[model samples]
Target: MYEPFFEMTNTPFRNDIDTDALYLSSDMSEVLSRLEYAAARQLFAVVTADVGCGKSTAIRRFTSKLSKENYEILYLSDSKLTPRWFYKGLLDQLGIESKFYRGDARRQLHQQLEIIHGIYKKHVVTIVDEAHLLAKETLEEIRFLLNTKMDSHQPMSLILVGQNELWDKLKLQHYAAIRQRIDLKCEIPQYDLSQTHEYIAAHLSYSGGAKEVFTDKAIDEIYRYSAGSARAINKLCTHALIYAAQRAKKLIDDHMIREVIAGELP
Candidate 1:
C-alpha cells in the first residue's frame, strides 16, 4: 500500500532482501573480509552476534562472492540438530548417500571432504548457522571432524555462525578441543546511530524510495526502539510505512513510529 506513495519499486524492509543491495557499513565490511579470509585459508572460524544483527546476511554476501570452481560451500541451519542428522545433512549437501550408522556416515563425509580438497583442488566450506542450539554430541562430532589427518592438513573449512551464547558454550572446559581449533573468531557489531540512519536510507534508496521518506525524528525513534538491530529496524519501519499509508500521510514521522511501537498500528 505504501509502495505507490513512497515510489518504491520493491519492498525495502523485507527480510530476504537481495545481498547485492545490502548497505555494507565499515563493520560489516570488516566481518565479511575476515570470513572470506577464513574460507581462503580453510580454517575453523566462529562468527557470533546478537540476534537479528545480520550475521547470516554477511555470510550470504561472502559465499555469493566465492568462485564455484574453487569452492564448495555447504550451509546448514537446524536448531534441533543431532550428530546423526548433522552427518546426514553434510552427506546430502555433498551429493553422497549417507551411511546407515552415524559412525560410517561421519567417515564417509570426511573422505568426501578430503577428495574435494585434495583431488578436486577445491576448498570445502561448511557453514553451520544457529549452532548455539546444537547438542553437545553434535558439537563434539564437529571437533572430531576437525581432527582428521591428525590436524596435519585442514580437509575443509568449518564456519560456525550463531548467537553470543555459542561463544559461551565453546568456552566450557569440555569443548576445549574445538575451542582451541578455532583460528578466527568474529562478532558482528550492532549499528551505531549514524549507521542506523544510513542503513534505513540505503534500503529506501535501493527500493526506489526517496531518502527523505523517513524523517529524522522518525529515524531516531526507530533507532531508540530497535537498539540498532537490523531485523528490528526493518520491522518497525515496515509497520510505520503501513500505518502512514493507512492515514494517508506522506512522510513517516515520530508519531507513526510511536504508534507502531505501542501496538496501536498493525
Candidate 2:
C-alpha cells in the first residue's frame, strides 16, 4: 500500500526479504565468520540470542554461503522434539528410514553420516533450532550422539540455535555435559542506538528511498520502542511507513512515530 507513496520498488522491512538484503553489521560479520569456522571443522556450536534479536537471520546468512556440493544441510525446529524423534528427523532428511528404537535409530544415523563423509566426501551440517525448548533428555541424547569413534571426532557440524535462555539452561550442572561438548558459542546482542539508526536507514535505502523520509527525532523514537532488536525495528518502521502513506505525509517525525506505535503496533 505504501510502495507508491514512499517511491519504493517494494516493501523492504519484511520477514521474507532476501538474505543479501540483511544488515552486515560488524558483530554479525564476526558471528558469521565464527560459524563458518565451526562448519569447516565439523564442530559443535551454539548460537543464542534474545527473542527477535536476529539469531535466525544470522543462521540464514551463514547457511546461504555454504556450497551445496561440499555440504549437506539438515535443519530441524521442533519444540517438542524427543531423543527418538530427533534421530528420526535427521534420518528422514537423509532419506533413510529410522529404526523404531532410539539406539537403533542412533546407530543408523551414525552409519549414514560416516558414509557421507568417508565415501560421498560431503560434510553434514545439522542445525537444531528452538533448542532451548527441547527436553533435557533430548539434549542429553545429543551429547551421546556426538560421542563417536572413541570420542575422537563428531560425524557432523552440529549447531544449536535458541534464545539466550538456552545458554542459561546450559550453564546449569544438569546440562554440564552438553555444555562441555560445545566447541564454539556465538551470542548475538541487540543493536545499540547507533546501529538502530543505521538499521532504519538501511531498510529505507533498500526500498529505494533516496532522501531521509524519517527525521532523526523519529528514529530516536523507534530506538526507544524497539530497543535495538532487528525484528522490532523492522516492524516499527514498516508500520510507520504505512501510517505515513495513509495520511499522505511526506516526512515522519517523532510525533508521527508515536501515533503509529500507539495505533498500529502491539
Candidate 3:
C-alpha cells in the first residue's frame, strides 16, 4: 500500500530478502569469511547467536556464494529431529534410500559422503539449523558422523547453527566430545546503533526507496525498542513506514516510530 507513496520498487524491511542484497556489517563480514574458510577446509563449525540475530541469513549468503561444481550444500532445520530421523534426513539429501536400521543408515551416509569427496571431488557441506533443540542421542550420532575417517581426511564440512543455548549445551561434560571436535566457532552479535541505522537504510535502498526516508530520531526509537536485533528493527521500521503512509506523512519521524512501538496506531 505504501510502495507508491514511498516511490519504492519493492517493499522494504521484508524478512525474505534476496541474499544478493543482504547488508554486510563488519562483524557479519568476518563471520562469513570464517565460515567460508571452515567450509573450504571441511571442518566442523558451530555458529551460535541469539534469536533474530541473522544466523540463518548469514548462512544463506554463504551458501549463495559457494560454487556448485566444488561444493554440495545440504541444509536441514528440524527442531524435533531424532537420531533415526537425522540419519534418514541426511540420506534423503544425499539421494540415498536409507537402510532399515540406524547403524546401516549411518554407514550408508558415510560411504556416500566419502564417494562424493573422493570420486566426485566435491566437498559436501551439511548445515544443521536450530541444532540447540537436537536430542542428546541425535547429537551423539552427529559426533560419530564426524568421526568418519578422522585419522586421515575429513569428507564433509559440518556446520551447526543454533541459538546461544547451543554454546551452553556444548559446555556440558556429556557433550564434551562434540565440543572438542568443533574446529571453528563463531557467533553473530546483535547489530550496534550505527549498524542498525545502516541496516534500515540498506533495506530501503535495496527496495529503491529514498534511503533517508527514516529520520535520525526515528532510527533512534527503532534501535531503542529493537535492542540492535536486525529482525526486530525490520519489523519496527516496516510498521513505522505503514503508519507514516496511513497518516499521509512525508517522512517517518520519531512520532511515527513511537506510535508503532506503543501500539497506538490502528
Rate residue 18 of model 2 by lDDT: 78
Point out where model 2 deviates above 4 Å: none
lDDT (10s digit) by residue, model 1, range 135-248: 899998888888867779787889999999999999999999879999999899898999999999889988887778889999999999989999999988888888888888
Structure candidate 1, residue pairs in collision: none
Residue pairs in clash, model 3: none
For candidate 3, the per-residue lDDT at 107 reads 87
Q: What are the Cα lDDT values of the candidates?
A: 0.89, 0.91, 0.88
Cα distance off (Å), candidate 2, residue 245 = 0.4
Off by over 4 Å in 3: 264-266
Using lDDT, rank the candidates from best to worst. Answer: 2, 1, 3
Residue-level lDDT tens digits of model 3 in 1-266: 88888889978888778998999999999999999999899999999999999998899899999999999998889999988888888889888888889889888988898899889999899999999999899999888887755546666899999999999999999999889989999999999989998998889889897777889998988999889998888878878877788888868888878878889433
The better-scoring model by lDDT among 1 and 2 is: 2
Each candidate's clash count: 0, 0, 0
lDDT of 2 at 59: 92
Candidate 2, residue 37: how far the Cα is off, in Å: 0.6
